[model samples]
Target: MTELLDIFRALADPTRLRIIALLREMELAIGELAAVLDQSQPRVSRHVRILVDAGIVERRREGSWVFLRITRDGAVGDTIARAGEWPYAPREALVIAHDARRLAAVRTERAAVAERYFAEHAPQWDAIRSRHVAESEVEAAMLAMMHNRRLGHLLDIGTGTGRMAEIFAPTARRVTALDRSPEMLRIARAKLSGQGLPVDLIQGDFLDLPMAGASIDSVVIHQALHFAQEPDRVIAEASRVLRGGGHLLVVDFAPHEDEDLRALAAHARLGFSDAQIRGWFASAGLLLENTETLEGGTLAVKLWLGRRRSDEDQPPVTQEGQGQRKRLAA
Candidate 1:
């Protein structure tokens, strides 16, 4: 079939193959891919066009930048995905090793740039983030908590760097990442451009989300509430967009005496307590479904799960796996 032949043709080029390999590591923007390949933007774009036309790669647009990644859903994407798994010939292995080294250098530069960005930003991110357990641990727990629920369109409120969007992409049919800062959104656009997930980045106010009422299936507020002047108002605005039966996941610091965070970090509030957040959800017509806390060296992080009422006439949705509350705060 012509379709099959197109795929073979796309893979025939060495540059295209290398691009596929690089994408397996993480999503990359067109500029990032060009840098990694040491090729011109126009030249790389042509190769990308070939793979994209063959349904082997996907492109996502965020602001002025475009990001690329190998497709992950279709048959051709599966075939391309197995390229790294297949044993390579001795000569081919050498080429791959060389590419791997180039990738390492590229990653080093990215890490350095990220470090500089964090250092320049206010709110001593390292100091605050250090208080909690590793991010990977918190993310894993979030996934576990969401395992039993039906996954749908997910809205990530204050998607600082698009990490939650990346993590929830596989389960969510679509993801809308909203942030107020254009600079942060720009960085997030580059970081989350690829992998074929339908992503939308918006620079807007959390107090009034630019969306229709009852349109979203799930809303996530990841470590962004303490920055808000009115955290409860933000929750109410989030609930306004929830489709009946949608869930809300809130992650933030539990109440703390970190006065330094208020001045040095630009924190509007020190932290939030369970009683306070739960009451906010109740006021917004959401019922508390689950609550878990993961204590860190200095500050304790909390995860609150709530569900919007489906209908007053309809029976309440019974959430399974609602075991004893996880109380790890110390």
Candidate 2:
């Protein structure tokens, strides 16, 4: 009862309630929240602290920036939703409507920042894009491969330009795009935010995904695996988040002698081989279902599609466990 009281007390304030309503729309950093609320940073931080202490909101630190989102555990979210059901002053709605307009300005600011970054790095990106097959053809292949199944809770790993998230968001039940670079995440956020798609852009490492095990249905690592020094660990991490029978799509370059790419482009590996990827899939409890190759300029792109093994497809116990069970029975 005391805990419930604390939650109510924390939410009793109009500023805190407004914060919750804005968060319900999308996750925002302290600065962005302040911009939308038309409040100072310190004041917003105090309100955020109250909400955090009450366990109604959670904060995730990415680099130097901290972002806030409504808590997703248990009935806490439902409780907040219930509170929103209560009658409020008519002006509250109008205030929120005004906030929505301010939010548009914030989005415009984000796009401008992202555009500056893209303009600065356009040459590098264009060089990389020229070596590979046309993105339109690759996207078509990807769509056809997964069109047969529903992408429940899709996770786009290393979502660079947010293209994959944009392509798959309409069909996915839930979309979350993760990238290691803060600048890239901002670029992705700008592209995804305007579409009215509920995408959570997270700044996180691919080797250690900030997601629970067996929670994601579809995972895509498109043209990003080459940047990882330990690609096997990345595959393992992707497999870890996949539910039974979930799909993992890896689109990257096949074997090549592109030493310039490693020296100039920051690529950890020149490319990958079919045998190596299959070995990784087997070790990660994923079955290699399909493989497609697109031959283009100097680099050839390969797509490996793997499916996580379901419980019905795997043994109930390991060999050692089974042996121990037999000895105990005897």
Candidate 3:
């Protein structure tokens, strides 16, 4: 009964209810939570304590940071279920508005922190971060996408180290690699330039690409979707630049249980499920061709191959374009 009372007390406050909603997607650290709640760390921590005691929230330690997630059981869940039985109240709007403002403030602060981290670490990112999946598989996935295409022009979004570009440059007439980090771009340019490849490097956010609509034949995003602030927007941008029947290949880590990524990267969501990816593609007016899951020792990679649709009632990627000619023979 005490637990139930504690849960009711926690939910009585609008701020705590907002916190619960945020935790539904991913676990977050106290500092990160505070940033999202637009409250002091101590205040967020205090609220979390009540929730924890009520058995509505659970905490786990990852490295030095403690992360919190919604607890399935205990007092809070029961209170929430009970609350649902009540008729709609006029005051619900007021509570929702108050919580929305607080949550917005928290999100704004978290974005600032994330931008600072990305800026500071941009230069040394390649050396500082180790690859969890095999480099060879990454190359193979890119190559597979280029296997049938004419490779007139290719765009690689978030082209860290130019791995995807390196594979595409051999077969592609022109390769444009876009990234936000000048330091990472430097390494990518050095590597691709050394190999005598014709690759153009651009430093920009993937969400706001500088390319025109229907300009590129193929677009590849490798292991970088998890870092996006607005992945759905990025997908739309990718679709916008691709010509009809052009392919978009995305390779990224499978979603797993990781609280640190949620906090540090401000990941709106984790590794995407096929259904989610398909929905995004459909929304963006693209047709899904295939999806492959590649399992590595430490991480799982999901590869999705999708193609832009044409206005005419022609089947996607007709036989003429499906010429079995391998383009990577430079």
Candidate 4:
């Protein structure tokens, strides 16, 4: 009763209520929230702390940035949604309209920044992705490859844009989408948020996962390893997390002499050869199940499917146990 009352009390504040309304648009940093609320970060953070304590919001740290988003898919979220529908007084309506304008401005700024980034990088992305067989075909291959197999606690490393997670979320028991960039995670959160599947958007490195050892049932590294400073270490870490009998899927370009990629896209390793990746898999205690290559203009994408050799494995949790970001505060 006390905890429930605490939640109601937290929302009783007009500022806090407004904060929830803004979060429904997208996750924001304290500074961003300050801008949207037209308040100092300190004051905004005080309200943020109260909401977090009341389970009305979630806070996560990505390097130096702290992001706040609504608490989704739960009783608290349902109650908040109902509250959001309350009839607004004249003052409340005026304040909300003003807040909405400020929020739109913030989103515009964010989109502009993202646009600049994509403008500089889109050519590089399209160049590499273009050569690859169409994305739909690759996705179909991935789906067929995992046909009829269990996808439990699936982890998508370097889940840029969270597309792979979205594709596999329907079948997987739970999906943990991990990435290093705060900006990318923000985009991913918007796409994955409010979905039926249990998806966790975590901002972290692919080489050093935040999950416990042997915690995931399946791992997907799609078009991400080529950027790794140390791809071997990445696979090794993936090995560390996979429970025995769990599956591993690596989708990347085959060995290529795309020297231009290094300068344009920051690709550390050009591409991986079958022998090189297979060696890494052997060292990681994963047995290669099959390798399929799809042809493209000048590149070939290889999919390596492997299974942990050890018979004993640990189950993480049911899909529902994964998370309820869908109900995050609206």
| C-alpha TM-score for every candidate | 0.62, 0.89, 0.54, 0.76
Candidate 4 residue pairs in clash (backbone atoms < 3 Å): 70-329, 71-327, 71-328, 71-329, 72-327, 72-328, 73-327, 73-328
Candidate 2 C-alpha lDDT tens digits along 1-330: 877888899989989988888887667899999988989999999999999999999998778888898987666777876755767789987887788788878888988998898899889888888988999999998988888886999999999889999999989988899999887877887777778885778889999999999999999999899999999999999999999999999999999997889876899988999999999999999999999999988999999999999988876798999899999999
Give RMSD to native, each candidate: 10.1, 3.2, 19.2, 10.1
Question: What local lDDT does model 1 show for residue 59?
Answer: 83
lDDT of 4 by residue, 2-52 (tens): 878988899899999889888876677899889988899999999999999
Extract clashing residue pairs from model 1.
Answer: 123-265
Report the candidate with higher TM-score, 3 versus 4: 4
Q: In model 2, how large is the Cα lDDT of residue 37?
A: 90
**Most TM-score-accurate candidate:** 2
Judged by lDDT, which candidate is best? 2
Clashes in predicted model 3: 2
Worst 10 residues of 1 by lDDT: 321-330
How much does candidate 1 score in TM-score?
A: 0.62
lDDT of 1: 0.83
Better of 2 and 4 by lDDT: 2
Q: After superposing candidate 3 on the true structure, give the runs of residues whose Cα lies further than 4 Å from its correct spot.
A: 1-132, 262-268, 313-330
